[model samples]
Target: MAKNKGSSRKGLMLVVLLLVLALGAGGANLYVLWSQSGKTQASELEDMPAAEPVPEPPHYVALEPFTVNLQSSQYDDRLLYVVITLGVADEQSKQQIEDYRPHLRSRLLMLLGEQEDEALLASGGRQALAEKVLALFDEPFAERLTAPQVKEVLFTEFVIQ
Candidate 1:
């Protein structure tokens, strides 16, 4: 009877230990759920990233069409008809280009006149021409502009005859 009592006491101790562990696990789960509930929807929304602002469109200005005579070659005389446009960063840059339009146009015409027929005939030649024109526009305004104001020199109309 003493041995039977000892076995029953061991079983009761094992049961009590398991109950205590189960209760501890349940209490931990409840604690986690309660902590999550403390952050309301408004607080969660505040943690989210704000939306980005939309950017403004770029500005462009068109120059008058220019017709210039290229240096003569053995074959025939070459005449260039080019309509140029300038892409500027802002209103102030555009205004600066406009303010010095005469000087820019004169330089471009002189540059075009200096080019040989063979030199301005291919795709590479045309790209070179645009770059040169952009340089002409940028050089005069180098003091005022933080960067080159002339972003691009686009030829809206280009014809060689």
Candidate 2:
């Protein structure tokens, strides 16, 4: 009976040891798989094409205030005082606009001077005026074959009297 008991205790110890070994092997396998997955992901990222760089914000160029006499049917004369700020596509466009400031101002004055007071005072007039201004700026300068990229025409101050 004592021998049988000793043999039974040895059998139990062997079973426990085998269980521990199996668990250790399983853990090592899992660790290897996890490490290999991380390496694969790293390699995939390296193989992918680089993303495009973020675009720059729009640049603004503010022009000096313009005051012009508005064409009026009435005996009383009318005037328009406005401040224009241009949103250019790039630095080059801004530079081009600055370089041709005098010519631009002259053209703008002529355009503004042709405006009727009643028409300018009407609703949607400001929007229409902005569109016209944008079109005017779209024209190419004498020095450059390509037009300066004028993205937007903003009216900072608009007053008609």
Candidate 3:
């Protein structure tokens, strides 16, 4: 009977110790949460750049559609037609593109006319061509005007047949 009583007391002490440890952990967690609650996110946002007045879309200039004959060395001739919209960074760049329109158009036409069907018909070829055209806009002009920053060359209509 004495041994049984001692065992029961030990079990109770063990349970009390466990409860105390759990309560300490919970209190520590609550302390952490309380500290975080005091810090408002609004205070941090003031230091960051304002995201307000959401930006408008980048301006663009629509170039005349291009139609080129791509005569394949491997197969039948395929005609390529692409409708392009060149993204200009700002009003100044737009004006630059308009000013040099004749020279720009001629350069683009020559580039397109030279592409053979075997190359243009490939899956990634059209995208590669678009990148090349974008690079062309950055080339130097006779006036030494600021290069037309062409952010993107969107092919609104692409057809190969």
Q: Which ten residues in a row have the lowest lDDT in candidate 2?
A: 137-146
lDDT of each: 0.82, 0.92, 0.84
Kindly report which residue stretches of model 1 are placed more than 4 angstroms away from their true locations once superposed.
1-48, 141-148
lDDT of 3 at 96: 82
Tens digits of per-residue lDDT for model 2, 1-161: 99999999999999999999999999999999999999999999999999999999889999999999999998378989999999999999999889889989999999999999888888998888999999996678785468999989999999998
TM per candidate comes to 0.65, 0.71, 0.63
Off by over 4 Å in 3: 1-53
CA lDDT of 158 in candidate 1?
87
Q: Which residue ranges in model 2 land beyond 4 Å of their true spot? A: 1-34, 40-53
Mind giving the per-residue lDDT tens digits that candidate 3 earns over 55-138? 877898998888887767766677888888988888888888888889988898888888887677778988889888988976
Error of 3 at 54 (Å): 2.8
Candidate 1 structure quality by residue, lDDT tens digits, 33-130: 88787766668889888877887688898999999888866557789898988888888778877877786788888998898778788669989988
